[model samples]
Target: MNGGVLRVKHHLVGGFSTVTLCPKVTDHVREEIKAFLLNKANAKAALQMQQPAFDYDEEVEEPRPSQPNLKKRKGPMDKFVAPTPPDVLKGRKDRKDIFGVCDKEERDNACRAIAKWFYDAAIPFNAANYDSFKEALELVGRYGSGFKPPSMYELRVPFLIKEVEEVENQLVEHKTEWAAKGCSIMSDGWRDSVVQKDIINFLVNSPKGSVFIKSVDVSEAVKDANLLFSMLDRMVDEVGEANVVQVVTDNASNYVKAGKFISV
Candidate 1:
């Protein structure tokens, strides 16, 4: 009817009739169909251009597929960026305040007491016990909110060295005063029980008190009169030869000879 003739054919397959149409189009109808198709294609292309293509540069988060009844897990970076606990912040503040409020003299006295406990009792230090000891001290005083203990290294080295130097200075002052009045010098040797090494210790007794001078390790095979004489001579030079009233030593044969040599 629209400038085209339709031819129809009917066939039976699988117990159903199927009809097919073959249209014989005229030149005018064929041209009309081509124009409509071209217009529709052009309109489709314009619509696509107006709507914009997906941008490869822009980031778009894809929705994650979720389980029916499970919580989402946190990523490593999310846990890292999480806020710190309130108690941790409070503890840091409390620590600074505790030190600021503590009396310096009391702190010094406590440190001395701790040193004496380890020194006088001859108790060896164990680094492993530090945390437990620190906790105990904290429990006894302020609740660990702001207390720290001396490290094992500080206790063994710097602090002990400082204390020893202070005492040595005091002793030196005392000796300078008393050495002028003359002092009796004594020497004795013994073997260390632990390492079985021979050691000789020297002391000077003045009107003030008996003060230890020095110790020499005589464990070498060359423990003879010359070694003894040299050790005693060094003491004489240190104590001042004129201030030494008498030199005394155990009646060991080597010490007896060393005494005679010094007397000369």
Candidate 2:
């Protein structure tokens, strides 16, 4: 045999015989062994391919990692572009500047006059504070007539009171005239500093040629049914009951009661 070697061995334990073949086997034997091995390996591989793959259900897939939330950074100009303070505060500062140089006497006089103007005009004390008084003085100085010397005070209380009273009297007269021609009345309650709660009464009418709104304030106690009825009675006394048409009011229980009482 060309480059072929054969060996025989006997196992002592099991009494088995073994034969080993080397690369130098005879050509015919080598070919036959090779063919047999090739066929056997191919058959084993094909069987394995035809069989179902074993899957390990115990294998677990991991969840994807969460990403960090990133906020957008503000630009450099954000601070500078912030909103300024309100105009009301700026207006107060400006008024304080105007009243800054006044003497104590002039300032006191101004305050008193301003306070009276507010009282007569029904402006609240809190609203007519120092700054507001100064602003009012400035407004009067700009718009009012007849300029007097510093000794007389630029915007006098007496002058404002007189003007306010005159206007009030004119309004009252006009309202009374409308009432005389027969008008509907509307009344509601409001609060004031001096009077915690007062009734604000008004009149409305549209005749063949006249339409008007007239108003007045009554004491808090007078907001009751008797008082409201009495007020209407007084109007009826003046204008006659036949001329009175209707009374309108808000949805307050008291007002509803008053309306029923009036209707009777």
Top candidate (lDDT): 1
Candidate 1, after superposition: displacement of residue 86 in Å?
A: 35
For each candidate in turn, the TM-score is: 0.43, 0.32
> Candidate 2 — what's its lDDT?
0.50
Q: Write the per-residue lDDT of candidate 1 for residues 1-264, one digit (tens) a residue.
A: 221111111111011122222246454654454344434434544454456344333221111111112223334453223222223333544566544545556667877888888888787778327786775554435222234557999999998999999989978876886667888889999999999899999998888788887888878768789988999999989888888899999998998999999999
Stretches off by above 4 angstroms in model 1 are 1-147, 156-158
List pairs with backbone clashes in candidate 1: none
Q: For each candidate in the order shown, give its overall lDDT on alpha carbons.
A: 0.62, 0.50
Question: What's every prediction's RMSD, in angstroms?
Answer: 34.9, 41.6
lDDT of 2 by residue, 1-264 (tens): 222221121111111123223435465654454444434434543454457343333211111111112122334553323221222223544666644656446657867876787789997667745685566556444322343433444347766778879867876665676566756655555667775655465555534333334445675354667766776666555544666677777677767777788888
Q: How many backbone collisions does model 1 have?
A: 0
